[model samples]
Target: MKTQLEELQTQLTKAKQYGTDQETLNKNLLRILKERANAERGIIPKKQHHGYIILCSQQLIKKDNIKYSEAVTAWKTQIQTPYPLNLKSSEIKDQIFKDFVEKNIFIEMEICTDSLDIKTECEVNLQQYLFRANTRTGYWEIELYTTGEITIPLNMQQPKKNATGSCSTFQKDSIKSNVR
Candidate 1:
């Protein structure tokens, strides 16, 4: 609860800088005050597990026909994609909140396979939730329980520097779930 209060205060400060509308700012200020009061009274927000699907890139190349002798280096360098799942989508929020449960929030993500454009769906039970409100948009940004670095294997044929894919950005009731 204290963490949440602090986040709210931070949002409020950012909201002022971002020129958020007065009406929305007022509402958020009221909400923050109420939450602060609750925190002082030892009241905590109920934990929730909102459901959403994270679209991950599986593979870009399909065929591997290069000979071993033609390879410049046999050793592979690991490329870590920072927060590949740090997605913000309003569509996802709508889908998740449509079936939102009050007491528990579990995020479901799919793992990618070796094949290009293929995904293997897996159910990961997230036991924790970190949520915040977007000060400018009044949207909910739910941080993922995992905030670790993701290692992405690079394609030897196409070794571009800092190659990352674009993710969907959703505002107005959004979730900023990242696996960075």
Candidate 2:
């Protein structure tokens, strides 16, 4: 199991470096490895799991008449992962705020509560597009002019109007990207 984990780690590194779609498969393999580790440590033993790579490779080699070497080298390349985000939390907030101001994204938030009724409306800037506050669904949404929209749910079915709302915190190491 340790050797398998090492091999999967190597594959994951290669996939990331080569910008291959195999990264997802490598990640899944890593997750399976973690589960196996947990089971070995006397955690709940999950049902046996197997990846379909072996069957797919076999089919490609036999049915498609492809060489084993060809099947092994079939790593579909994709866009490389973006550079890591290393900005501080304050820096991230500043950058996001700058983007909002630059994009001219209008933000409006309201909160009202009574003995029996609680209602909130919130709009945050996302992707320099049209923003909407869905008070009924308790989600702040940003609809792109193109096709889809990005919806961020409010915590506990309520939107908090503050410097930082109910969204996840932007830690220095964990933040992946800025507004872009």
lDDT top scorer: 1
Q: Best candidate, TM-score-wise?
A: 1
lDDT for each of the candidates?
0.32, 0.28
- Write down the RMSD of candidate 2 (Cα, Å): 26.0
Lowest lDDT block of 10, candidate 1: 74-83
- The sequence of per-residue lDDT tens digits that candidate 1 reaches over residues 46-159 is 111111212122211112323343422111112111111233454334433333332122222221222223354533222233444434323334533322222322221112
lDDT of 1 at 170: 29
Model 2 misplaced regions, further than 4 Å: 1-20, 45-180
The alpha-carbon RMSD values of the candidates against the true structure, listed in the order shown, are 19.3, 26.0
Candidate 2 C-alpha lDDT tens digits along 1-180: 999999999999987877766666755654565355333322333323211000000000122323344431111101100011232334334433343344322121121112212244423212222223333322233322211122312211221221212223212221122222
